[model samples]
Target: MPVTSVTTDTEALTLTVVADFPVPVERLWGAFADPRKLERFWGPPGYPATFDRYELRPGGIAHYWMTSPEGERFYGRWDFSEIEEPDRIVVLDSFADAEGEIDTSVPSGRMTLLFESTATGSRLTAVSESPTLEALEQVLAMGQAEGMREAFGQLDVVLAELREYALGKGTVTEVLDDTHVRITRAFEAPRHLLWRAHTEPELMRKWLLGPGGWEMTACENDFVVGGSYRNAWAPVGDTVGEPFGFDGENLVIDPERRIVTTERMTGAPFPANVNDLSFDEDGGITLLTLIISFPDVAQRDMVLATGMTTGMEASYQRLESEILASV
Candidate 1:
C-alpha cells in the first residue's frame, strides 16, 4: 500500500496519485531513473514491462511495452520534457504501436512526477494532465487508478536490495479505501504450482482450511472464464462453529498469472465482491496479490471486523508449511 491517495479533478483535467516510500529521495528517484528498476514496477501485477529504449535526460524518449498474461503486448512511449535530478521529472506520455510510433487515436497526456523528502522517508506525487476532461474520464474508466496503485505496490520489492521485504511476513492486508482492500502473501513456491494449489480441488482441500479447528468439507471448482466455483468448511470434532462456504463466478482467468471473480457468501444478503487475484514470480518465489472490491463501506468494514486477515494468514501459513513444503 505505498499509494496514499489517488484523486481525479474534472475541472483541472488531471489524475493525481501520491505515494510514500520508506526510502530516501535519491533511492526513490533511482528506481524510476534506471530502466531495469522501472521495468520491475512500471506495470500492474501480471502485466510485466520491458523497456526497449530509455533516455533520462531532457528531450529524450523512452519506449516500453507491457506484456499481458495472454502474451499480448501493449506499447507506450514517454518523451521526457524536463528532468531535475532527485527532484522532478516531466514527460509526455503516449500510447504507441508495435513500431514504437505514437498512436494518436487515443489521447496522450503530460505527466509530472515530483519527489520530495518526508520525515519517514520520501514522497512521490504524480500528476497526469489530459487536454480534455473526456480524455481524463476515458483513462479513469480504463482502470488507471487501480492500475497505478497496483504498479506502485510492486515498488517495495524493487526497493529492497536484500529481497527480504516480504520473506516470512505471512500475510499483509491494506485497506486501500472504504470499499477496496488489498491482501498480499509470498511463498517459496513456483508460480505454476501455486496456481495449481488454487485451481485443483485436491490441493485446495489440503490447505484452504482457515484455522486448525476447521476442515474443508467440500471443494469444487471450474477454473475458467464464466465458470462457477464453490467451497465449504466446517468445524471439526468438538469445535463450535457452523459450516460456511463461498460461491463465486470467474470473470477473467489468465491461466497461472491472474484471475478475476465475483464472490459472495453462501447465504449472505448483500451484493457480491469482485476479487482480482494476481501472481508474480521471481526466481522460485511467488507473490500472491488479491484486491477485493466490496459493494460498500459497511460491507468492507464488516468483513475486516470478522478477523478476515487473521484467518487468511492462518490459511496461507498452512499453504506454505504443508503444500509448498511438500513441493
Candidate 2:
C-alpha cells in the first residue's frame, strides 16, 4: 500500500488521507476491523501493539496497548459508532487506562475511516475531528500530523508483509499548562541541609544560581509576612549586557516545618505572583513541594510556556550536586 494523496483543512483542523492498496476491499476492512489484524498494522514501524477487548459494532469499544522502543507504554481506546462490513468504520478515539477507561482530562477526538473497492485494488480515507479549534491547533503543534503519517505508513508496510505483533505507545503529551503539573521529589539529605539549600543565601546562590551569566546582587529574607526579598541578576560573559531582576514579598514562613510562601515578580512589570514551598521529612528523605499559583489561566500558561519545569529540574539537579559535594 502507498499513500496516493494527503490533504488537511486548517480551518476545520481535519485531515484526509487517501491511500491505494493492492489488496481488495474485504482485506482492507479486515485490517482495521479485526483486533489481531489491526494490531499487526497499527502504530509506526518499530512500535508494537496489543489488543485487550475489541468489539467491532455500534456502541462497542476496543482497547489497545502500545509500547515504544524506549519501553514507554501508552493505552488507547476506540468507541465504535458505525461498523459497516467491507466498507467503513467510525469511532471516537482517546487515551485510556489499562482497564480501557478513557482519560477525560486529556484532549481526544472522533474519527471516521472509509474503505472502497477500486478497479486496481482498494482506496482508504480517514478523517478526524477535534472538539475545539484550540485543541486542534495544539495537536498539530504537537507534531501529531507527521506522527500519524509515519504510523500509517508503517501500517501500510505491515499490511503488505502480513506481519504480526505491531508495537508502539499512543501519542505523547506535552505539558501545555502549569495547572496540569505538580512537582514532587525527595532529597536524600536531611531536613536541615534541604532547608539551608533553600534558605541560606550563600548555599542558595551556589545551587540555585550555579555559574549562570547572571549574579544574585540582592537577597534579603526577613522570613515573615510583609517581609521582602530581592535578587538582581546581571548577565556575565557574553550575556553581560542583559539585565534581570526578581523581587518578592514573603507572605508566610514556618521554619519549624520548613515551609515558605512568597509573592514574586516574574521579571515582568506586573505585580508579584504567589509561590508556596513546603517541606516534609520522612525518616531521612526530605520531600519538597514548590507550588506557584497564578492570578488566572493566562498567567499560568505564560509561566508554563517559558519552560519552567525544565528550569526547576535543572535547579534541583544543581542543588543536589552541591549538597553531595558538601557531604
Candidate 3:
C-alpha cells in the first residue's frame, strides 16, 4: 500500500518518492540515523526488518534483512556516501547476500533523500539515480518504486508513535501545592514559537481541535490582562455531539514567560478552572509548564479521574507537530 506518489522518470534517470508528514522534519530525519528507528519502517508492508549491522556515516554501511510474510528473508545494504543531519542523505542501495555482501548480479541505486519544510508540514523527496538509464530501468522493473512507497507508509506508523510523546514526556504529572495540576513537557521548538502557537488564533485552531471529526469554528483572543478570549468548536458532518465552547478572561500576560487565564466551559459538568502556562527556553528548545487549577480538591480529583491527562498529552502532540513545526 503506497502512502503517496511514487514517480519514475527514465529521461532524468531517477525514481522519486514523495511523502508529506504533519510532523517536524527532525522527527522524520531521525529515522535514518537511528538503527532501531530504521528497522521499524525500512521494509515494505507485511515485511518487517531486522538490522544486522548499522553504521550511518560517510563511507559506512547499513545491513539489514526483511522477514517476509512466509518467514523468507530479503537482505539489503546501504552504502553511504554523504550524511547530512536533518536534511539529506545519500546512499548506494543494493541487494545483499546472506553474509552481508553486495549482490553484484543485481543493480544498485544511488539514492538521495531531501527533506523540505513546507508551509503546513514537511515534504520528503527521495530520488534514486543510477549510472545508466538501463540500470535505472533494471531496478524499476524489480519493484523498487512500489517497495519504497510501502516502506514510506510504514514510516508513518513509526512517526505517529514517536509524536504521541513528541517531547519525550517526563511521564510525571506534578500536583503542585495540591491545587495547581501542573503538566510539564519539553518541546523541540523555540519558546517564542511555542508562545505564538498558543496566543495566535489561526495557529491555535489547528492543534486545539477537540477529539476527531471536530473543528474549531471561532477563536477570539485579547492578550491583555483585563481582556477576554473565547473559542468555540462544533463537530463536523453528522458527528453526534453538542458543540463545545471555552470562554476565559486573561488574568496575567508576561509575553513568552507566563500566562494565566480563567476558563469556563459552556458545556458538560466540568467546573471553571484557571490555567497558567509558563514557558522556558533552553537554546532552541522550549519547556512549557501548564498548570490547571480548580476551586477545590473534589473538582481536581474529578477532573483527573476523567482521564484528562491523556487528552492533554494528545493535544500537546498536535501543538508540537502541527503548529510549531509549521512555524
Please give the CA lDDT of all the candidate structures: 0.86, 0.65, 0.76
**Can you list the residue pairs that collide in candidate 3?**
none
For residues 238-268, write the lDDT of model 1, one tens digit per residue: 8999899999898778678777788899998
Error of 1 at 41 (Å): 4.2
Specify the highest-lDDT model's number: 1
Count: clashes, candidate 2: 9
lDDT of 2 at 323: 64
RMSD of 2: 15.5
Q: Give the TM-score of candidate 3.
A: 0.49
TM-score result, candidate 1: 0.70
Predict model 2's lDDT versus the native: 0.65
* Runs of candidate 3 exceeding 4 Å displacement: 1-3, 162-327
Better of 1 and 2 by lDDT: 1
